[model samples]
Target chain A: MADVAYLPGLPRMLPALLPADDNSSPWRFPQYFADHFSEVMGWLWAHTWLSVVPVIAGLIIALPIGWLASRHKWAYPPMMTVSGLLYTIPSIALFVLVPPLLGLDPLSPLQVPIALTVYSVALLVRVVADGLGSVSEETLQAATAIGYTPVGRFFTVELPIAVPVITAGLRVAVVANVSIVAVAGTIGMVNLGLLFDQGFKLSTDTPYYPPIVLGLLLCVLLALVLDLLVILLGRMLTPWRKAVRS
Target chain B: MIGNVLRWLNDPDNWNGTQFTTGIWAQLQTHLLYSVIAVLAALVIGLPLGLAIGHTGRATSLISGLNAVRALPTVGVLVLLVVIIAPHFHGRTSKGYIIPTLIVLILLAVPPILSNTYAGVQNVDPAVRDAAYGMGMTGPQVLWRVELPNSLPLIFSGLRSATLQVIATATIAAYVTLGGLGRFIYDGLAQQDYPQMISGGVLVAALALIADLVLALVQRYTVSRGLTKRFSKSTVGGAVAADLEEAGVEHT
Candidate 1:
């Protein structure tokens, strides 16, 4: 890590070593930073796109299912159990499972998103179920008493009350996905995991090399950013948690 | 059409017979061994560290550093660190690989173990601790006689998930050329063997299921044998009843 005897960049060190993906013209960095930035950005970009769809799709699937499961004891157990089982399947295995049945090639980029989404299903589902379960019983009874229909109760009363829990779950899902999606490189898209593979490969190629250090820095930075986002997401959604903590 | 050694030996096939198992059965034996070793390794390392991390106030100071370690991408970090570490001890040999696998698995297992242990210890009913302490018990005795027993169920609960996780993840060992059931999953694909791939996937899942069942049974045993919160509550109640009557402060 201390291999670089000198440090110089635009004014100061911000670790802005990666550029956003663009087309039409080659988006390039200074020769020194280019290799480092490209690898970092490659991973960051692939992971972000791979994660976004699953997260959004999961939220859509999770919230309603959680709401329905919350309504009755009969529903909760099976839904939770199945999702739990799905979640427990190792991600790699899950990725492997899809190809034979779905007719999708194992090597396809689709494996990354599909496997991640399957994992997210369980997290989001549990979050939704737990959040709605946590809504005060009295509020539920009052909603019923006030002649609110089941659907009305869900949207107006249940959902509003449960948003914080769902939010918490989504925060967890996003962070977990970020940590997890690094594995996508095993199937071979140049992500953060790929950078590590590259850096490791580079070790015998060049001693005290630049790209390897840059990759490690980017990975740590990526983790920090994702972690901060989860925290910020929690704070944004549930201000009451702040008050409670205080 | 293998595994007819008895028939071959007795009557039909050959004078001397020892049958080789089919691919799936061979893989099953391998899977079971790997899962058991991986889970056992996790529990052995995870439990004590979990206990220390939970019980000691000074250890709480280390959570952030520990969490960062825990948060590291398990495969990537291990792959990177292992390369630097492996020159002296390569991944294939027992001396080189076992320690690293244990290290990675321990890192993976500790977060859940520590979280549960800390949560469990925090949730131990205070009155039970007080009663044990009041009985002229030493601090260590109180922890063992009261807190440890009280937290056993929670610890086991965490272990359930952690053990399953370790079993599932032990597949990553295959990537480092430290082969396990994951070999069927990864190496099978590289070789284009679908049955090997499917068999490996199923074995991992089955191993996970069995691990969970065993842990669940252990949880049941702990709960039934009176090592959990319910038993602690009742015992604490008895002590309280004795103390109150001794003080002559009864008659509600």
Candidate 2:
């Protein structure tokens, strides 16, 4: 039902609004621009690692932080506030500061991923905190009365209740962080951002357009695709999302 | 550790400068001004557009597009825009960068406020709409008089959240070589002054925390108070929602 809301020709609008300016037609994108699909694929290949690694690292940290935050009432809020504070610090400053204390090259690939992971930590911590927090105290008390051990109660009781919120939070954080990693490319060991920077420097003749557009497209697609997965995950993981079996 | 932090917080002058330093107050004032301008700009653009989208059929498309934009890498965007736009503004001195920095910060602010307002308006009770209609109210009249007032509580939460975020993030504007507390952060790091860098970093972090707390209080006091004016909204919502259910009809 919701799918019908999307405009049928919505995908075509961007090109219509900003006509393709490729006079050089280096790729010779033939009868249909999609004919240059190989180029898009190539571009995707170049940046896929940068996008994926940071998101993966963010997830690994956020899941536990979210879980811990959700379980403890007092623990969740203060830490979340702290994390929120951490979330606001500009990435550039944070990166610059790290090299001084950690001896890590500020521009290193490891540095970007590490910085991105820290950013993701704030998001995940908040999400897990909120998700677990929403498990009604009534349900929690009921679980305790039934003799579920603290750990047993977490896995069996609280976690199930929190899954939907946690999944949604993870989805949002992933989308936000992946884009950040792309920015990391601007100053990293290897990144598509470097391509955009290169393209900008070279002007229209730059190898930038195809890669920049393709990279942006990839980023947008990842966001949309991941969002759908999160929706599906939510539906599968939570009773609330699924329609009652008639 | 706590004592060290306390020592920093305790001395009134320490807030603006630690021992015998001036310009701490100036830096603090500049940071506050930049954040305030950015947040206000975002609110101005976001609130009205959000109201329009929230109440219309076009909402889903607009909000999704905005979300996509919101997910954009802030640093990357700055870098990209700086290439095209920053050059025009570049001056022999730092002041030239201020306008572009504000413009970009404003761009960052829009999504949170817009999304929050949309969500707030969306959550407003449909029964309230019906009641306004029942009173022979026109659409805009109903929207402004009934829907917006009712949506205030949630809408304020969005603004609070967004503004707090803007305050934390506006520090990034310092990267353009403009002056703010962020300038301190960059300078501290470049000079390898941990105490000064940490001090600036810690202060900015504290500002964000304080902003979050203050806004949460604001959301509660102002937005909720605004809702009390429409005291019957919830009750009307319940009555109408129940009635609609009985009719085997519900509209999202």
Candidate 3:
């Protein structure tokens, strides 16, 4: 809920603050879409990157922590408590808090992704730990009995079985990231959220339909595409599941 | 910094106002009012739908479709709805903001409640369900007496998550010129008042934690003792993890 004061180092990209009457219409669907197609695409691309990079980064960071929590009985409660607490912090608060904690400029684009990555880490750590825990003990014993080293067994045996659950976690994280990234736009990051901000300010006197509708459509489309990509990737990685199914 | 925030909070001027109608208490009330109404709205809509879906084994695709709504950005949705709906209430600006804010809050709260309730009922042991039916309980009776009780833990978990989410998000309502504890953070940010902003953040977090703790206790006392022992080993984190898995299933 922090104020939206303009900062010097940030780009002078106040789309919402543009004079509302400059365009002189409440709706400009055809003309606006035609003129901003490439620009919209660019925002979509940035939005995709902003949402996905955090999930990837978070996964990398969470893997070891998740493994630790799953492997050690004593670690599970403490690990879950810490990560759960981390998840409860409000997104807006976290966005503002991160600047001071990380020594970044308040309006830096990096803050959005960093805060999202923290969220993804918090959400995924428990998922990863739970997914790993879901692997059957007998399967693990079989791997161990086959003279596989602990590391080898984990890589070859445990992780493979854990893929389905981990993929589910990834799906949730990716979708959540998509939503959180839009919040960044509210904070002045250059993404599809700019359209929302513009639409909001533009409609100060009269409702502006095009930008708001377009922003919602594009945001949903991007989310669906990313979600489908994760599902497809999951399917590709787990061919045995299909074999078992058919 | 903490002392400064504490001092600011304790300031007589900050606390002084008309009796029972101003200061931090009023903002807390507004925040709680928004969150409670939204959660209740979500419950009214989601609980029945989830129960129906779980009981009948139909309309599951509806749940999956609704799950996608979770990915819709809350802020964007709020702004979009405001722009679309605000003009209708041309004379009353505050009502315009409040209506869209409540709509968005309800939208955000519905999914977890819907999904968890459905999953909880569906996941109930089938043998128990069959036994209840054999004992001459009607469908509604079984759902009310048997399934609902069993699903209490998950339903409570969903409500807890939904309440926390709504409370956190109600802060954004302040961005649209509505009043809540978020006023402090936003106003402080504008004035570059770090202590006030940080204090707002702390207060909101404290509220969320307290709300969660209270719900956990409610979950403890409301469910039967046997059910508690059955799930005693499962912590809040575990319940949340399970809920996330249900969410994934609903999406898929």
Candidate 4:
């Protein structure tokens, strides 16, 4: 059972590595985590990068596009339509399609992050546009009256006001990306998703519960943490909202 | 790559097998079957619960919890369910795989439908409800006639979004050895057949686009024209906001 090959370059983390004297049920999570520390951390590290870098990249890419959409009212509909169409494509399909489109290798790990970045951009463009659009015309006029340049005013006044809205979009994108990274395991990309694949592959006779449970726990936990971080960032960026509420 | 995809799609051999279920047509049917069943099941369960929460305004806090459910990884939940439940079938024919796949898809679908319905109902103009009450409409009658009708645009948007998500996930059902367009991608990947894999991506994407288009048309016809026009004006922002709320993006 241990001899079945894994995806190339994937470390063979297995239940069989446990102590020989153990005869307990497959629910031995503490023991499993203790034994496979490096492997678990490795999965977590890869999962974090794949899930996060995309959101940051997407934000940077989307800001200008989203700003353009907000500025030119006519650009809003067509841009939203295109992004909506992009969003409808399944994550799994995008994972497979990305490599060929970019001339990357079939098994390249880069595909997962690139695919996720596409999703992030698709999701964020609307959020950024709407966030910026939410800025009151009066506020813009005030900023201009203060002699702030267009670019300066955008960064200092418009962007700060848009924080709550954009961050709301960021929270969703980050959380969604966490889950999507797991789907990459199906295509042999390494991440926490590999745990699900490993668990499935190992469960020939009876169900292997440890890795599956671990993967789910880690994923939900990661999503929750990342979500809270976005909320915190949003709060920090908009202390005036908090001040007004209080 | 385009030639490879064209040739692979054009190949007669790729379209047939010893049994009808082995063909692309059968696989497409299977994919739709799984998606429809899951969506219908979720609607039956979620619609009423959401409606109850919306109508009475009790237990509305539960909506946030439901929205958070969106963050659960689809692939993780699918694999976890299959592993936990498959053993109960004692290695019986693919019931093990199918049941779990359906469950995951159902779970994937419920949140948007439920949250959207709740938001839709909750967002109904209070004046309309007061007018209905003044006309001697009972509580249930108000919900059924006034609230439900008013909320159709949002409900339909929720349904469309849910349907699109369900279709995409149904493709992943192929990963667990179920039949769908995903089979082409997964099978092609395993065998290192890039054209077959890419074509599978094209087919799944095309199907999602068509499904979304059909739903949009249905929404256009079914929703009142006045509401549709009003929604179209702000839908670029409104729909995304509704979707974001349904996703539980705003805790405050």
- All DockQ scores: 0.19, 0.15, 0.29, 0.42
Model 1 CAPRI rating = incorrect
Global Cα RMSD, each model? 9.5, 10.0, 9.1, 8.2
lDDT of 4 at B177: 89
The better candidate by TM-score, 2 or 4, is 4
lDDT of 3 by residue, B128-239 (tens): 8999999999999999999999998899989988988898889878877787877777777777787777677777777888888888888888987545543433787557
Lowest lDDT sum, 10 consecutive residues, model 2 chain B, at B82-91
- Best of the two (1, 2) by lDDT: 2
Chain A TM-scores, per candidate, are 0.74, 0.74, 0.87, 0.89
Q: Going through the candidates in order, what is chain B's TM-score?
A: 0.70, 0.78, 0.87, 0.87
Give the Å shift of residue B114 in candidate 4: 0.4
> Tens-digit lDDT track for model 1 on B118-184?
6677677788778887889997777666777788778877777777667766776666556566766
Q: Return the DockQ of model 1.
A: 0.19
lDDT of residue A151 for candidate 2? 89
DockQ, prediction 4: 0.42
Judged by DockQ cut-offs, is candidate 3 incorrect, acceptable, medium or high?
A: acceptable
lDDT of 1 by residue, A1-246 (tens): 454434322222222223333311112313324645655676677766765678888888777788778777699989988897787777667766666556765466777777788888888888888888888879999999989998898888887677777766776677667657666565455566675555445444222224334444555566567667766876776677688999
Task: Give interface RMSD (Å), model 2.
Answer: 6.5
Better of 2 and 4 by lDDT: 4
Measured by lDDT, the strongest candidate is 4
Residue A191 shift from truth in candidate 2, angstroms? 5.3
Error of 2 at B91 (Å): 5.7
Tens digit of lDDT per residue, candidate 2, span A82-106?
Answer: 7876776655455544543466543
lDDT of 2 at A35: 51
